[model samples]
Target chain A: MLIIGEKINSTRQRINRALISKDSHYIQQVAVDQVANGAQVLDVNCGINIKNEPELMSWLVRIVQEKVKVSLVIDSPNPDALEAGLKVHQGSAIVNSITAEKNRYEKILPLVKKYQAKVIALTIDEKGMPRTARERFDLAKKLVKVTAEHGIPAKDVYIDSLVHPVSTEPQQVTEFLEALRLIKTLPDVQTICGLSNVSFGLPNRSLLNATFVAMVLCSGLDAAIIDPTDKSIRSAIKAAEALLNRDQYCASYIAAHRESKL
Target chain B: MIDPKQIAENLINGQAPKVKELVEQALKDGLTPGQILKEGLIEGMNVVGTRFKANEFYIPEVLVAARAMHAGMDILKPLLAKSGDKPTVKFMIGTVKGDLHDIGKNLVGMMMEGAGFEVIDVGIDVSPEKFVEAVKEKKPHVVGMSALLTTTMPSIKTSIEALKSAGVRDKTKILIGGAPITENFAQEVGADGYAPDAASAVDKARELLQQR
Candidate 1:
């Protein structure tokens, strides 16, 4: 599975403070650490100060890329910030999201096409979040068709079923897993989710999150926006992959074990 | 024989039908609508809000409890209005322009309703002009703005500015919040109050009104 490091997002208090203070060293260390811990892509979000987002996004894109070799996921709701980050981002970056909301889709798709970036398409529209597997699948299908029409291929489109808090909506996990299975039936599009949202408002969140990750992997999740530095979650991913026979002869699991021992 | 405490307990447990039934029973047994509202619905929702803040109750629980509160409110609303016991404070809420997110805003609206405020949700992607127009028409005691994205956060200030230019800024207390909003940001934007979460939004709304 592709692991998108979610640590550099400015929503967290520390990251928000760092971004506001222009702490380049703190931001770079986080990027380097995630990549070292097995993140192949880092999601950089500098949405702390709206007025400074464009400047901060580009600055973050530049500084983080200077320290790491991985591709990036420019996560922002602001088209300006996305463009600013894309302008400076070196590899083929992944745009964090494009939703089916008419205005958002119109505003973000051209940027994705212009930048030739892979895109994460969320199952949301003007009506807000989908409440069932059918709703999610329908939105996913629409996103795939729309992005394809916009000249972005299905393979480059990542469909996020949008995990709701299972604590709030107990059936949400079942619905999410079902949606993932249904989404895989679509032609060549990838499936991803933010792991922590499933465990929101629940105690022993890490336990719920790790277990949910295993469940989604079993349901054919291709990628996850997650804290790559979470040891338990990493172990869960490796173990699940090995158990599901996605790992060849459990080689990746053995390598992980050896590295941990070292 | 209807006990208001029983009504409160049923509301807390999210038994909407039971809460309504008990409120009806309380009224039929000579309890005032005000008494049932205070000792039953509001009393129950206060526990819900406190538990939510303490991490004991999550969104599902709070939402369910709010539904129960609404069920009881339906029984008392007409009677209260007839008796000139309408909810004292009116709150108008919306997600600022360019932001379509409303989960947080909805939560605050529900909590405020539970706290006995008459809430008018102007919905998401509300422009500054819409805010100014609503402030003029609704004449709400407090105006709350929400923005989940850092990109949309500036719209809060813009809306406040619009209200100021329209000369309606002082007519209502402005409260700002969302994932990206901070107390400092609220102050910088010249808002009257800021709350980090939905439960506190209720307290802040009450506190802001009291200061008026």
Candidate 2:
């Protein structure tokens, strides 16, 4: 599974303080640690200060790339910040999201095409977040079709089924899993989710998150936006991958076990 | 022949219609609204809260059970008011300005209501001035603020300051919560209490109120 590191986002208090102070060392350390902990891609977001986001996004993109060789997921709702990060980003980055909302779709897609980058498309529209699996699937199909029309291949598009918190919406986890299964049927497209969202407003969040990771893996999730630093979640993914026969003869699992011992 | 235990069971299962029916039957069978509320609806919700804290009952189950409790309350409220059976605590809650997220706030409100607190939800994106105005007008025993984003969290402090300026700060206990809020932040903002989640919010509010 593709692991996108979610730790460097500015919504987190530590990251927000670090961003405001332009603490390159702190940002670089977090980037390096996420990569070390098994994040194949880092998602950098600096949306806390909307006015300074463009500068901060580019600065973060540069500092993180300097410390880590992996690609990034430039995360921002602001088009200017997306462009700013994309401009300085060394590798082909993934645009963290575009929705089915007409204004957002129009604004973000051109940047994806312009940068020749992968894109995460959320199953949302002008009407707001879809509540049912069928609604999410319908939006997923629409997103795939539109991105395809924009010359982006299905393989390059990542459909995020948008995991709502199970604490508030109990039936949503089932709906999200069903949406993942449906989204998988769309030829060559990948599926991703923000793993922590499912456990919001609940106790034992990491346990819930790890369990949800395994469940989503079973439902055909290809990537996850997650805190790679959490050992339980990392172990859960490895265990799930081994059980699903995705890890070649359980080689990854056995290697991970040995690595933990060291 | 109406049994409060049956009402509690129906409520625990989120059988709203059954709960309402049992409540009506219990009332007609000469039980006071207070007796039915304490033994039936609140009793069931207390179990729901415990299960929720234990992670056996999730948000949806609690929500439906709260809905069932509300169904029973709708029948008993008027009669309870006429009989001078008032809930001891009045709670006023709102999501702070520039943050529209309210699931946490709403959950806290529902849990408070289920716990027999008179909850006055001022809704989301509420300004500091608006909170001050509500606290003055509602004259609640406790004022709760919620902010889902780190950026919006500072508004909780601002609202508290507004309450102080409006001379209502001493009248109400200030309780703050949200995904981004912590006990340390609560202290930094001069809040009387902080809860990490809705279930705990009720406990924290009760603890704060008891300190007074």
Candidate 3:
């Protein structure tokens, strides 16, 4: 599975303080740790602190790239910050999101085309988040069509079958999985989600998240934005991969346990 | 005759508008408002609570079902009041100081409301003094606290200490929950009980009420 490390985001107090202090060592260590813990992509966000977003985005990209070889996912609500990160990133990056909203697509797609970056397409529109899998599927179809219109290939699009917390709605997980399954059926369109979303408002969040990860993987999730250093998620993903035969002969699982001294 | 059982079914299915209409129709059918309150809204929410505790239902399900039950309550509240009826228990809840996390608290609040308790939400980042002030003002039967961060978990004890000093500690049962909290921590903080989730929080609150 493709793991996008989510720990570097500034919403986390430590990361936020690190960013404010220009603590490159802390940021770099987090990036290195994520890569060491199996992150293939590092999701970089300046958090809700938007005052110096463009500068912080570039600084984060440069600092993380210095210590790690993984590609970056430029996560920002602002297109300018995303553009800043894309420009500073060493290789082609993944634009961490765009939605089915016309304004968002129009603003972000040109940058994707310019940067030649992979894109995470959220199945949402001006009407806000879709509550059902069918609605999400329809939005996914629209997203693919719109991205294709921008000359981006279907393979380059990662459909985020948005996972609302199951604690808030019992059927949200089922709907999200169903959307993911449907998205997988579309040729070359990959599926991804924020792994912790399933457990929000619930107790023992790690257990819920780990179990949901295994379940979504079975439902055809291609990647996830999550805390790569979380032991429960790490173990769950490795075990699920082995059980699903995605890890050939359990080599990855065995290697992981050996490396972690487990 | 509008069946109260159908009201329960509508609530389970999260049909708020239908539940509202059915509740009004039942009242029009000459049913006692108390009977509608007990057999319809409360019964429906009881099923939701049980399902939630069993993990058969999740947060969104409980929220919607509660809203449906509220719809039934809206029509019944005044009538039940005219008949001198009221939910016997009152719950006061909040996230502890330095903790902005309210989702867990909100869930517990919602579940408490669904289970026919009057819930007073004290909001997030509440200090010990603030909690004491609320206890003094609301005089709630139960005071529930939550904290998602380990950093803020100690505030639960602080709040409890404040309540004790205010002499209202014995007046209300204190319940604690959050990601970093355990039953042992709850006891350590001098809480009456600890709940693992929203559904269990309701059960725990009821148990505390019974003890009181």
Candidate 4:
């Protein structure tokens, strides 16, 4: 599974404040925590709230990458910001997202192709985020198809089936699952989630999120926006994968356990 | 001609129309809209949540299910409202100041409403003073604050401090949360409670009310 450390993003208040203030120390600390905790890929979204964004993202990317060896997930809503980010990354990175919107695809895909980076694809369009699961799923299919036509393989794309909370819409959980199942049925299309999204409002959220991770693994999710530092979640994934037969004889789990001295 | 179960399945599969069709059919078949909502739509969501917690569902499936549930809710809201059924709880929520992120806050608000709470949302970039103002005006039993950044986490502390200083902190139990917040942090802030995510927030709120 692809663990995209979401900690490096500037959307979080500390990161945003740090970016606005140009606090390299703070940025480096977050990058360090995300990697040491276990993020295979660090999503660097320099989207500062109430601060400078483009230059900040670039500056952050440079500093955060130095703190860890994990591949970067260059995250930005703006195409220009993404492009700017790509110029600084040392190796193949993952572009945090792409929607089916014509402008998004037109603006972003070239950079993906240029850097040979993977991408997180959202199933929405210029009209905005769809209100229904089918709308989002169908949008994903179309986005995958269109992007594929541009020589970007579907395998290089990670589909984010935006999960809303169950307490609201109630069916959001089910709808996102259906979309995931369908995506799994597709050839070469990978699946991920902004894992934090599922627990958006409930209490003891990590428990629910950990449980949700198991579910996503069941539905063939290949990546996630998550905190690798959380042991409950990481351990849950290992156990779930073993149950799903994704882990051959639980070798990886055993190895991880031994590494942790557990 | 749509089966409610099929609608439930489709909703889980992210087919909103199918769920709506089933809801309408259930309604036309003399089933109370509330019955269709609780049995067909809400019940399906519960299953999705349980499944999600068990690792049997993924984000796409969960989202599609939410969409499907929404399609059905659209048909039931007026009917449910007209029926005069009392909502389960009342809540006020927002993301802490210096933070513009709202998806998590919105999700929590939506879920609280879904879980039967009448949610009063203050939206993003909110200060503790705003929280105090909302509490003074709405008098909700619980106030939920969200922060997506660690730097803004201090703002959560500041909000709690503001709540305490306003002397209204006792009037409304403050529930602090966000990606960076820990239970330890919540206690340090003098908040009445802390929840890590939207769904657990509902459970915790319920637990808090029960304790009170």
TM-score of each: 0.91, 0.74, 0.63, 0.58
Which candidate's TM-score is highest? 1
Model 2, B1-212: lDDT tens digits are 78899998999999999999999999999999999988898889888888888778877788899999999999999999999998989999999986667788888898898888999999988999999889889899998899986567878888999889989899999999887677888898899999887888889888988899
lDDT of 3 by residue, A1-262 (tens): 8999998887576888899999999999999999988899999988445568889899999999989998999997678998999998988899978999898889999999999999999887876678899999999999999999999999999999778777766777888888888888899998889988788756789999999999989998888999988989989999999999999999999998888822
lDDT on C-alpha atoms for all candidate structures: 0.90, 0.89, 0.87, 0.77
lDDT measured at residue A38 in model 4 versus the true structure, 0 to 100? 69
Judged by DockQ cut-offs, the docking class of candidate 4 is incorrect
lDDT of 1 by residue, B64-149 (tens): 89899999998899999999999999999999997867678888998898888899999999999999999999999999999987
Which lDDT tens digits does candidate 1 get at residues A131-219?
89999999999999999888999999999988877755788789989999999999899999899978876788888888999999999
Backbone clashes for every candidate come to: 0, 0, 5, 40
Model 4 lDDT per residue over A139-203, tens place: 88997888797778999888886887654456778778878888787799888898776775456
- Give the native contact fraction of candidate 1: 0.58
Residue B12, candidate 2: Cα error in Å is: 9.6
Docking class of 1: acceptable
Ten-residue region with minimum lDDT total, candidate 1 chain B: B98-107
| TM-score-sorted candidate list, best first | 1, 2, 3, 4
Number of the candidate with higher DockQ, 1 or 4: 1
RMSD of 4: 11.9
* Range of the 10 consecutive residues with the lowest summed lDDT in candidate 2 chain B: B148-157
Candidate 3, B-chain TM: 0.95
**lDDT score of residue B67 within candidate 3:** 86
